[model samples]
Target: VSCIARHISLTVGCCWLDGENQPHMKAVFPTEKAVHDHFENLLRILSYEPLYAQIRIKRSNDETVLVGSSLIYFLFIVQMRNMDWLSDLNTTLKNTMVSIIDASINDEVAMCCYGVLCEILTDEESKDLSISDNICNYFLQMLEDIWNKTKKKYEHVPIMMLLKGFQTLSKNDSMQQETAVSNRIHIFIEICDEYPIAYDVIWALSFNKDIQQQLRSDSPFICKLTQLSRQPENEQMSKIIDGILWNLEINHENRSMTDKHNTKEFDIMISYSHKEKVLCKQIYEELIKAGYRVWIDFDQMHGNVMDAMAQAIEQSNTVIMCMSEQYRKSNYCRAEAQYAFQRERKIVPILLQKQYKPDGWLLFIIGQLLYVDFNKYEFSRAMQMLHNELKVELMAETHTAPVRPKEDSVVAHSTTYISPPEVLRSSIVSENILDWTQSQVQDWLLGHNLRQLSRLFAACDGRSLLYLSKYMKNCEPQQILDLLEADSVRRLNESISLIELSSFHSVMHEKKKRLPSMYSSNT
Candidate 1:
């Protein structure tokens, strides 16, 4: 019986029951009855537990151990595929799994026990079992054990499963104490070299606000992670480091942030990543020399910095976003852009990444605004265009009265009349997308959930938008965004006399790609 159970478990569990593939597999084969049938058969097999499970007596060692190990794999994988199965499991079966973990002396049986425990305890809604101090301590103890075995080649699968439960488990009272959270953080760091997934565990832990605050207070810990980010082993590792750094920024000592939200602020508020500090500083210097008051957080802000940013935005007239992949990744930067957008403040985005463009939340925030691409234009020219959009008058057309023929001119004296070319008015909203005035584009954006981006479309009619969609059909999502941004600024230059260059929304062009092929036929 044990030999048969082991063979069935190996074929079914390893080949047919990988957790990640189950969701799509179930969707394709919508026969839930098949899984229910498997569940019934598995429970009947578990009904015949060894004598040791009932009376604490030793059984025929290897045979019973193999059967028990294979049975628990069945439980774990089934629970993964149908999570509700764990909650439906009876109280006796639940205790049996935990009991196996508590008593198993063999490493194979112990690993299977950990796997089942991970499936069971990770779900907080499992009414039969909630995590306690014992369970939390067990995960920490096992992680410590893994770290302590210097020369042993132990399985890292159990460690990963334990971290999954520990992640959800850390939210309850069992992990409320600072020391418990801190210890897990340390152990994850220690084991990260051998088990690189350990870094992911630490990153996940940072999502809890309280734990994020705790990590921020530990200056040395934040400093160490920052150093690690500088020399990441790979792109995935680089993203992990960026995510951690984005979450737990540094805390400057001996300086409590004052209530500057109500105070007098600069005319232009500069929001950029510290990675672009040199460029940000130059922008700040030039703005200052031009006599425009500016706000750039020259001193790197660390902890609890959003409040002052809100206040600064409230008092500022213009916000200059020095955008890059790094800036978009920061929660702090996103918050600032979002708040500025919410207030309907004018935004001027200057792209900093070589080929990067915004997406998701960042994309929505800068959608309809004038985009200044530093990568495409020379520094002096980009700044000059930025100034023209701001109405600073560098190469800007000065509005003047139209020159008319003299009173005695021959055309003026003649009775013959002439007709001039007809131009579309900015206020007109066309039925066709191609003939659309920019103002109509603004109304279309406002009708959507995009209040942050409603300006800068006064001159971009349906043809401009259609061409933009066709031109960007093959480009990446990011490239399309940046290209459209540069195109928005180019449109702004033509309408500089009447343009305000105010900011936010960009989903329309992307949605345009999905339009019927007939829409392309009109042009």
Candidate 2:
């Protein structure tokens, strides 16, 4: 009787009564032919249903019996792992197993049931079982709850096994499975945050084009992953997150570039010598007000100066050269022009000085390109010409101007330039100038060039220049030109004419006499 009970507990706990349970009993009791013959009629009369019902009745009668019955169900699941019983599980039996899992608090029993469910869900033979979405959601919810509660307390082996099972289920190419995985991206990110092991799951999901599109659209989630990737403690996690972000950013940029109306980071990087800064500054301010993203050195001061310049040139769509005698003389300015030319970045040269003509490397770089001539026109007129030229250049680059409908008398120009909307105007013109305290600004003016100082003083009060100079001290001499330009625009109530090179020293001498009290205070 004990032998019969043990065999019955193992065979009948998970299987239904009518179909395969009787055949399984015959296999378990094969050596005891007489015993099997003796019990065949009784077993046929009382199949798995009556036996399982009796176990439940006993379990309800005693707490210890309930635990024992759970262990019996757990053991039956473990034994069936080697067998192909997944497809044979009917809806009622599967529900009973899930119910046992829900009611039990024992880790062993719960884990065993979880393993059984994972096996069945992932098994190829059970693909046609028609598992409901509600059941899958409930199963995942229970697993997540358990993981949240015990993940820190226990080893990750059991949780990893469950996650591996989930990854396996997602590996299938069916639309339903793909949809299921895509809907849980937030959950997957949570898993990634909590368990580094789940990064493989994220890596796998990224290969699916649809999943990549979904992640790209969800910027906040991607940003969270980016913040995690920047942490210094975990190199492996950082690399994986970086790869995911790279894939997402590359795909997003490719799509955006195809639509030519999209605005990029910077339209141009203004490269010039500090000697020609006064005019360069004016040009910079005008470009900003006109809605072009101009990368001069002022706003990009976070890293090594040369690297920053190179990166800016690479990121910009074109390089705007404020060409002059000083631009050709300075090694740093020459380097910027050569680097831009080598990178195949469009070079738009604006002649800043009247007598200066391009030669040597400058001539080699911009000699062939048509340039905007500031020398020939009045300041405002020259600016309008430059603006118009920029419009033409941008139209040529984008190749996306809208066409007018055909008319009998009108000719359609496919390359017509359109003015950018006012809303596209850069906030750099309106954003607060770099934060600099008054004392820090005073320290920078102690030994600076008189002409640069005169220009700074003209644009702002001595105190404001001193304050603004604190932020400008680390900037390259060329970038300081841009900062001075932006400062002059932000603080000056009226437009100042560009200082003439020949008269710059004489003007500085006059300005020096007017600011004697300022010099005295500094002394």
Candidate 3:
């Protein structure tokens, strides 16, 4: 009906169509609200028309006014049409947009504009969509300027915009200018530390094949930035890292899929108290029989139980905590359990003792997790249930969700780097801060999964990020990358920036002068 009215209006030209009176013209809408309604109706009809499609900004009084975000509303449809259409929108217009983004006073409006722009740029409606270098640079410069000037005010929003802008830039194969990308990334990481939005930017940047490759072959900036970003929300850092590993595994699986090779089996460490060792052993043996390798730490540590624990947990598929009478009573078990819990591992607790419940204060510590029970001698049934559950959970966490390319499966949302929502918004508070060892950070990251990492990062101090960075310098690049993941790297990226802002960057560099650079001549 709206389309028919619009078509009749166009045919009649400068005339309003009437509902009755036999194809007669009616008076124009007198009120603003009525005019808005008529215009919105017209826009709805215009959206379907081939030529007028993708027109979110309209010109009527010789001014480019935002229409309905209707273009972005139908973003998928527009994206399906042709991304080349975006390139045709005139570079001058994009430049004007850059100016508008810079000059805008209303943060809300600026955010809306930013959203619209990002929606268009990252639109996945078209397979071969391309964004131009000049436009990307314009947004990048705008973001950089905002970061440098508004560090004290609106500290976080800029980095998110910068990240989204960079995402579009990163997608441009033509824009693979290594130096430019690296410098932008460096500045981005720097700003992320001071501001709360670093995670989004770093997360987006890590998706770029070139950026990922460049990061691997690190220079000093990359090494420092990588360490810094992995510092915060150690738990999130772990998830982001796990997400990366999952991606790598998916890639590996794709390469090996055709050969019908057996899926690789992995060992998981079971850390329990001596009293629960029998139950733990039962679970461990069950896992081994089900085709999973298992590791159990029964006795006391020889040298560094921390490192040994870290190594064991890092190699495992999951960490099984036998939450029983002995585990609840032993501080050693609880401490080790907490450490493994922080590493983003798939933790399964076999509830053994009905009398042993987490305490009142530990309620805050334990959250609302429901543990599997195996307190009785129903060992066989419990073992079978554990095997099935472990198999499913392990596969889901480790494997990428299969994709149907022809159907345009939602762009593989698993990021190469992931971060928690909190890290992108706030700073580390005093109460949450804890002085932790490097080995501790590694164990925390390698042992837990994403959900747990968010809580751990939230509970950490700013110093912990730098501490982790320094500690990680001793580990191999692959090991570090495996532990940090892209999301964690992003957090570390921001942490580095915060340190620099506090003049702690210089302090850390001075403090760690003896540490060998990952990007040094060794590469």
User: Which candidate comes out best when scored by TM-score?
Assistant: 1
- Put down candidate 1 lDDT per residue, 1-523, tens digits, no spaces: 6576566545444533455455544553356566556655655565454633432223345455444545554544544533344446645456666666565555545544544554444223232354343455666777688556664324423445555445434333224343245445677766677776666656656645666776677777677777776673575665556656654653222332343232333456788887888887776776665555566678643322444465557655578888875575454576678768877667888887676656545677889665777777777756655654443211122222223322421111111111110111123355567767664654454444233233344345667756655565566867756655666556443232112212221354444456656476775
lDDT of 2 by residue, 117-147 (tens): 5444432323444443333454455456656
Predictions in order: lDDT: 0.54, 0.50, 0.42
Assess candidate 2 and give its lDDT: 0.50
lDDT of 2 at 471: 46
Residue 92 of model 2: what lDDT? Answer: 38
Query: Which candidate number maximizes lDDT?
Result: 1
Point out the worst 10-residue segment of candidate 1 by lDDT: 412-421
- Backbone collision count in every prediction? 6, 1, 25
Model 3 error, position 155 (Å): 15
lDDT of 3 at 350: 63
Determine the backbone clash count of candidate 2.
1
Clashes in model 1: which pairs? 368-505, 433-462, 434-462, 438-457, 453-504, 453-505
lDDT of 3 by residue, 1-523 (tens): 4355344434333321221131322244444354345434534443343322223232231111232222222222222222233333424333433344454444433443444454343222112323333444555566666666745323223344344434444432333353246356666556655543454344444544655565445465445544643554454443333233222222122221121122222335676767656666666665655545556654444332334444455444567777643354333454456555555566766676554554421233346653555644267756644543454345343332222222212112111111211211222232211344432332333233322232224334435655555556676856754554554444322212222223433433553465445213222
